[model samples]
Structure formats: C-alpha cells, structure tokens
Target: MSAGLRVAGVDGCPRLADGSGGWIAVIIEPGNAMKAERIDRLAELVDRPEAPQIIAVDMPIGLPKRVGPNGRAPERLVRPRLGMRQSSVFSMPSRAAVYAALDPRLPDEAERYRHACSVARATSEPPRAVSRQAFHIFGKIAEIDGLLRERAALAGRIHECHPEVSFWAMNGETALDLAKKVKNAPHKPGLALRRRLLAAQGFAEALTSPLQARALKVGEDDLIDACAAAWTARRIAHGQAIGFPTPAERDGEGLPIQIQA
Candidate 1:
C-alpha cells in the first residue's frame, strides 16, 4: 500500500429532531489529519470525491439464509473474546428476515420490528428473534448489504468491524474492563479508557475530543467508536489486521462474513 493511502472509520448515528439519521465517519488522511462528517447515507461516504481506500464500518455485513445457533460465524468467533462487552455483538438473522423488516409497507417501526422477529424466528435454527438493538439497525445493515450487492468493486474496500472488537485488538487482544455505557448512558471511565487506547494508536486529541463531536449530533461514545474503527482501517491498509475467523466465510450473495480488526 502507498504511504499516501486514506482510510475511514464509520458508525451509525442517532436521528436528528427533523426525522433524519445517518452515519458518522472519521476519515483519516495520510498524515493522520482527520475529517469528521455526518453522512445521511452510506453511499455518500462511498461516492464522495477522494473516497476512502478502506472503510471500516461498525455495521453488520453478509446476511445468511439460515443462521446457526451462534448466529453468523464472525459473531460467534469474536463475542467470546469481548468478555462483558460481548453483549454489544448482536446475533444477525437471515437475509429474508432483514429484508422483510425493512419493507416500506410495514407502516411503523414497531410493526417492522414485530414482523422482522417473526421472520427471524422461522429462519433461525434455534428459532431466535432479532434483538431490539439489532432490529433498529436493520436499515443500516440493508444499506451496506445492498451497496455491496450492487457495486462489486466496493466489496473489498468496505468491511464489517465492531468497535469493541477493534478496541480489544488495540488493547493488546484483551477486553477492556468497563462498558462504554450503563443504563443507556455514557460512562466516563469507560470512554476515557477507549480514548487512551486510541491515543496510544496515534490519534490526536482533536479527533477524539468529545466537545467536537457533540456539535454534530454525534455521541461521544460514537465518536470514540468511529475512531477505533479508523484505527482498524489503518491496520488493514497496512496488512496488519486480522479477521474474527482465521479464514472468512461467505454468505449466499458471496459477501464476506467475517469481522476484521
């Protein structure tokens, strides 16, 4: 890889008061300078001028037709290594379930959630339903899934990554002691721990600072998560990153089914 290659780290963000939500991205340039932006669509990141060479996104990829007991291969492989943070890993349902959940005719979110769970239970081996956390992000998952299926060229550049897994890799392959949130609220100690880890990876205060993220409607935790993913993107660009499974699996659509960090 050229020393001038650019990479990005991205995480889904909360909706604005105007009923719009999207992803937050941290684009790391050649010299480590960063650009943080809120993009309303995943395509915006991929289609922008000077698009990133590698995109390490905190979103699920590669939906399976029938999920096994541990969900997809990647979730099962990395969850155990996360310790308490394992809860952050949601078991992905089948491709049909995901597509059904995002059906425009569903009317509302609650209806979509219920409909998705019904499909999920029927498609999963152990008859599992989708978690609320996971269900909420089905649209985001669908966005990337559709993008990969449509643009074969992007399949290699855009990768699935989890912040906790990225953080675990950054913390010398050990899980962090604290949770990023408690009762759905940010935990300062945990955020501090993550910031320290990112700093150790050469991230400057400007990129990781909470105040800078707040103005953009991006949560502090999310900003930290995006930075962690960017760290993984850097490692990947340098051929230093590793996938959850020793060898990545593939979905029916041929999308890679492994999380890399």
Candidate 2:
C-alpha cells in the first residue's frame, strides 16, 4: 500500500511438509500494525514504492569469509549485552555449514550434525558449533540470505536484530530472571513477559489477540520474537536504535553483519 514511512519486524522458520514454514513481518505504522508471512509478503511490505524506513528481521544478516574466519564479530560483541542470557546468541553457522545443512545425501540426523559441525569448525576461529536447533533452522537462514543477496535494494532499509537482545533492551536492558522458553513449555510465559514489554510500547492489542498471533504460522516464540524485532525497528526508524559495534562489520557482499536493538 502506498503510504507514509513505516517500520517492520520479520522472523523466519523452516518450510514444514505442508509448505507452512516462511517469514512473518509485523508492520508498524503510526498507530497500526499488521502481521504477514512469506518472502512475497515481506516484499509486498518492504518493496513498496514508498517503502518502510527500516525493517528489522530476527535472522543472521551476513556470512563469514572463506578464510580468516571469526564466525561473526557481532556475536562476540553482543554477548555481554545479553548478560546472564548470553548463550541465547548462538554463533551463527558459517556459510559452509549453511550449505551443508541443505545437502540431500547427508543420510541421517547424526550425519547431518557431523557435517554441519565439521564445516563450522573448518570455517571459524576457535570453531563455533551449530546447534542442532540452529542446523534445523538453516533453511530459514538460507532463505533470507538469498533474498538479501538478490534484492540488494533492501540493504539500508532492512537490518539484523536479535529478539532476546531486543526484549532485554525493551525492559531497560536488564537480564531476565525467567528461563529461556521451550516449545512445549505449557503456554510460554516468556511470551507473556515479552508481550507485556511490547504492550508498553503500544503493540498490546496485536500481541494479545489470538487471531492476530495466529496470522503467522511460526511457533509462539517466533511470533513474540517478531514483536521484539518490531520494537527494535521502531527505534531504528525513529533514530533511537543502538548498534552492537560502533562501526558495524560488513560481509564481503557489504551486508552488515552486526546486531542492532
């Protein structure tokens, strides 16, 4: 829709057997927000002629070099900011690990795990390991990677954000006492906490409505994550976002490999 400057938050997940996995973008205009999914939906929002000022997505934005690797610089820098929950920021799987995850002949889950870890070790300094969780989500990572690389115009307008970091910052940048949310954790209280923080920012209605949260097919945590990202996007578009590295490190392709919240 042709409109004034808006901001957005996007999160992605795997494509389920039902073709259900994709991206979810929470768009925030002056006083309105609508949730959407898929790369096409993301394009519809970010590719408009007027386009949003900034669209923050909860995905790793860049890849490490073929050689001389340190995984990603921002992960190292952003860890301290996350404090007690620093482990929430996993070292992004190197580009090689990403491609390896897509291999069809990887056989069983163990084989896939081995391949991913091996690639990560060879590509990173001190060898960052890709969690099984991270390996499973590589499809989403690969999808965003393709979109950003193909549609170069989205560069300056789209930024990388980590939801936990966003949530921490939203709550005055302090550590949370609760445990990290698990998928089967009885209705996710973590979402409730994050929802409260977002409500304070005026996204209360969207986060509270069942119909609204179901608009995106991703998991509950992913939806809350997208909300946290929206909060960060609001800051960036309004010139209040805090960048992890004073001068962000960019990938060889020039995509910023930094975290912002």
Candidate 3:
C-alpha cells in the first residue's frame, strides 16, 4: 500500500459514429483516504507515477475473426444474430483471445489487433449494403471510415495520458453487470472501500465532464461502467477474490472462458 494504484477504463459504441464512438477514462488514487482531497491530487496520482499496477481499458483490443465486404476488418468479433441486417457487427473476442492480444501490448498499442488466423471470413452483405449502412449511421457515405479513425485516436489519447500504468482491457458488458461484479469481488477492506468511493466520484464526473456527457448522449450509464471497471482493476491489483462467470457466460463470441479479476 505504500505506492498508489492506477486504473484506466474505456467504453466503445461500435455502432455509433462521430468520434463519439465511445469513451475512455483513467483514475489513479493513493492508498490513503487523503488522496481524494482534491481533483488535482487525483490527476497527479495518475500522471506523476513511475509505474503503477493495473490499467483497465474498455475497447476491443483485437480484430474480429472475419472481414467486412468493404475490406474493413472488425476490431473485435461478435456473434451473429438471426434477422440482423448489419453486415459487420459489434462483438467481443474470447477472453483468451483478448488476453492473448492485449497482454503483450500492455500500456501501449492498447488499441491494436494481435490475434492471427489462417483464413479470413467474409461478410454476408454486399459492398453496397455495407456502404448504405455506414452512410446511415454517420450521415455520409465515407463516415464509417472516419468513425473508426476517431475511435483509434481516442484510444491513443488514453494510452498517452497514463504511460506508466500497466494497462488491462475490460468491457463490463453493461453498467449493472459491472456493478454486480465489483460488489461481489473480494478485496482488502481499504481497497474495496476506496473503490466504492471512486465509483461515487465517477458518477459525479459523468454529469460534469462535458466530453463524457456528450459522448454518452444520455444519462450516467457510461460513467457508472467506467467506474465499475476501475473498481474491478482495484480488486485485480490487490490479488483479491473475484466473481465467477455463470454457466451461461460468454464473450463477444458464444464461446466460454474463465472469468477473473
């Protein structure tokens, strides 16, 4: 507990365009309660640290198993649903795949694709359909590419903001899911309490930070998810207990993997 802990969180709206594709936020706090005395204190804890433990990001850190007809590849893979009209979809990679791809890029390339496959799968839709959908979402024929570029830029910004923390990728699935996960995860009393406090702070920040509010285009759900990810990082850093995935649990893929903190 001598050195403080640093954690990062990222949220992505794969379906959305407008650099508003999603949001990423990082928080660093001291082991002591006095760390919350001021906003500047919190920023200093994250920015000035030498090499802290645990940074969590909420993006697809790898490419999907398939490629779109437009020759654009998925940043992460998701399962196909019946009657879904989209050519490429927003899906998550398997935990094994995510860990494999992201672990090597810790604290950098936090947005790069790492997995390799012998063959690339093609999308079901035609090139024109893909183009139409992209245009519909982004308001222009070429906006889809612009959105992807913006997402990458935001990911790069998060990495640059905290170069010293060991980054981990996290996608809570949902705010409620993240809340339940962190509430049940085991942790030292001090760290656990700190997480709760951080959660409250994030909730507040969501309302105040113009960027987060504008990106979410809604209430504080995104903030809650970001905070929950930070709490999960705290539990992971302390080597504390974490919850298990239910029998029905699955990643962006329908495949199963072990859950950890």
Comparing candidate 1 with candidate 2, which one achieves the higher TM-score?
1
lDDT of 3 by residue, 1-261 (tens): 324655544332332444433343435455422111111111232345442345443333323334434332322112121112122233332223323333444444422232211111122223111222222222211122223344543222222111011111222221111121234352244233333454454434433243554554522334434554555555555654132322223224332222233
Worst 10 residues of 1 by lDDT: 15-24
Tens-place lDDT digits, model 1, residues 84-199: 99999999999999988898997898998899999999998889999998888888999899999999889889999999999999999999999989999999999999999988
User: Clashing residue pairs in candidate 1, if any?
Assistant: none
lDDT for each residue of candidate 2 in 90-152, tens digit (9 for 90 to 100) = 768677788787788976878878888888878777666678767877776776677788888
Q: What is the TM-score of each candidate against the true structure?
A: 0.97, 0.84, 0.34
Candidate with better TM-score, 2 vs 3:
2
Q: What is the RMSD of candidate 1?
A: 1.1
lDDT (Cα atoms) of all candidates against the true structure = 0.90, 0.73, 0.32
- Residue pairs clashing in model 3 are 10-58, 78-91, 92-252
Off-target runs (Cα >4 Å) in candidate 1 are 19-21
Output the better candidate (1/3) by TM-score. Answer: 1
How are the candidates ranked when ordered by lDDT, highest leading? 1, 2, 3
lDDT of 2: 0.73
Model 1 residue-pair collision total: 0
